[model samples]
Target: MPQSYVKRILNARIYDLAVETPLEDMPLISDRTKNNVIIKREDLQPVFSFKVRGAYNCLLQLTDEQRKGGVIAASAGNHAQGLALSAKHLGVNATIVMPRTTPMIKVEAVKRRGAKVVLHGDTYDEASEHAHSLVEEKGMTYIPPYDHPDVIAGQGTVAMELLRQHSGPIDAVFIPVGGGGLCAGMAAYIKYVRPEVKVYAVEPEDAACLKLAMDRKRRAVLPQVGIFADGVAVAQIGKETYRVLKDTIDGVITCSADEMCAAIKDIFEDTRSIAEPAGALSLAGLKKYVAENGVEGQTLVTINSGANTNFDRLRYISEQTEIGEQREAIFAVTIPEEPGSYKKFCSLLGKRSITEFNYRYADNRDAHIFVGMQILPGGNDRQEIVEKLQKHGYDVVDMTDNDIAKLHIRHMVGGHAPQVENEIVYRFEFPERPGALLQFLTKLAGRWNISMFHYRNHGSAYGRVLVGMQVPSKERKQLEALLSELNYGYSDETDNPAYQYFLS
Candidate 1:
């Protein structure tokens, strides 16, 4: 049976370490959706996340002996800082085992809070495992990021503030879910007090553990999770949070990394504050909910859960925002190899603004043109543009949502591998470490020649590389063996359309 969670929230000893964050009305999103949209600005917390509340609440329950023993925990980013700050406030030592996938800025922030930082494996689960091992070795208290009663109650304080801040009718409350502590606490309180108000839990599509749990009627573990929204990229929902979610939350929604990036842009445009991907997750889900359910003029509220964004990530986020919002589209068009063909193709687009155009001339009868166009509101749909080009006797392929087109192809428009045979293009992501690239190259052992290589560091947790290896058919099995031994996350992209069209 559920305890009196609202009472527990009211009594959670956390006010000394956490502030009552504001509930700001979002005029831009509200005006766009024609609804009263408000954001619970938990991002304004001293720790830049609502996590401090739960972290402090959990630590407050520690015995004097336990506090003296210190605490151990694992986190991707936000929870680490929250717990670190809480431990500092209570004069307790904190050891945070964090995933290497966490951004450098976040790692530095956690250390700045006076926590002993342990950079472990690539995922939160791996970090958690290391933390648990420390618990047994050091006899320190293990502070879970979520799944505990105290933590849940502490997170419930968010809903308490929400209900008190706005007594008016609210159609729904959208919350971002990772381990689900925030959703569990808030949903339980909201359901107990204002039963009419619906609660929605939002997650990234690449890591929708709550949605999977709801569908299966039990806790579900994801085989893999997206790293973009690292704040909420949990492989499995916490058992305690799943229990509360099943009983109290009305629905679960999922959005893509691109959509979250778009939400980040939306928040920045309105509030002049940049939110991390997980912080903007609730707003992304809200947009999807409105578009799918045809919701209009209803009061919807979502929490800006955290603002612990890495400044360098803003470039990639900005690049993806327009595509996420459907305000920009890209295409590859085929036209005749004649002098007037370019002029004719331009005429077909009418007055639509062309954002990009890339063409590499080859001695062929037909030529391909990679084009990017601005998509105005209330303008012609992408398909309409394609159809118009088709009517003009030009073949077109839409590449707006093609990740290869977005990530690599557009950057290097065309580079034909003339005589390179058996060229296998592979994309790999490896942990950023000194001599990492050299180590990978050494592991290959000169079995194959590298025909092409491309790498750009935009300050991500991992280094991304696009490599074209000239491996013969007879050596394919050998190459696979080497890759398995080297053990880097990779994908074979030899047959990718972007590769075939732009770089073949």
Candidate 2:
């Protein structure tokens, strides 16, 4: 089956729109990881993503009648821009149905490419349904984001260029997976041409649809998926893509959000290019593989998939990079609330630099301090610091891996509100769109009295809000029902240790 795709990939008519992206060496990452590391510069494509290759190739196969009828697709961002640009080049009309939560920049980009942009529902599924309806009504062909043979063959061109560009031996290739189109295509080509070179698929930890599918030995849909790497936040691997990838891919690696952020920084340092979280996903997996296996002196390659990230998200990415790189450790330590206690604590820390120190008076007997310090890149250093503090008779709780602590508590470390009773804390992520906050407040505020609230914009597809509301025990079920009706992703955090230490 893999052999069957070789000719189609070689003959894919994408050169008119898609350039042959270069394979560039990452000198800094190569030296740091002790491997000859290189990256496929797919991010440098005209559409700033490799999606154009498949979009154009698929369009080239369309019959003259299909071209006259045009094409329709539902995409969060990249795919829409790709199809729009491709259609413009071929003189075919395109209709793109995008989620309302899609960033303005992408919507405008599609419009500028002469595509009719339809702002549909909050999620891709909703927009996709609307797109299908339009396809029937307008008698247009439906262009799936990543499920067709033509598209897969088109994406395989990346591998064709990669192997041709680098004739030297390559140990492995890392490709990021969303609906698995790029991974499936690339893996098929690589396995067919060079069976010894392993192909690994990379996915976000919270959006590991391909990994789950591989484990289950069948395609499975995720109930929900995290959208931090919005480009690859697909809840299900495509039917056709899963078919090819299940056989061709050597393994799957999933990385956390923090790890992806660190990879973004890594790409920036090596190439001076800012990659979107999904764009840097393969590099994150490559780093994890090298560290976990203690691998060295091998040639590794990964693709920089895209570079269409919103500028505002860089702040959040920068904040998490230190922790992602294991260069920062955060903890909650209790000390006596008396004179010279701070000095004593500092003395114990010795020469280590403190990244953050937040404390507020709670009682005379003991005081809880939220502290952050620089640490070496390994698990051992963080553990040593924790053990040292505990050995000094100080109660220490590691907050470095705590989501609430890093995202909210670090910015809201104030004394506990003793007077607030029956308070329940919940973290919620809702579609980030106009009047979304107002709608959320209108539905949630009337029944329960708000005790605490914190909201920050990371400029992704969703808005995260932490809310503490006072609901009596008897009315807890009512609150749950209301939350279910609200239809937002939420998690109760009342028992979170970060909140227990600083803001309960």
**For this target, which candidate reaches the highest lDDT against the unseen true structure?**
2
Candidate 1 residue 71 Cα shift, in angstroms, is 0.7
Backbone atom clashes (below 3 Å) for every candidate? 0, 0
Task: Write model 1 residue lDDT over 123-184, tens digit each, in one string.
Answer: 66788899999999999999888899899999899999999999999999999999899999
CA shift of 19, model 1, Å: 0.7
Q: Model 1 — TM-score against the truth?
A: 0.96
Model 2 bad stretches (over 4 Å): none
* Minimal lDDT window, size 10, model 2: 436-445
- Tell me the lDDT of candidate 2: 0.93
Q: What is the total number of backbone clashes in candidate 1?
A: 0
What C-alpha lDDT do the candidate models reach, one value each? Answer: 0.87, 0.93
lDDT for model 1, on a 0 to 1 scale?
Answer: 0.87
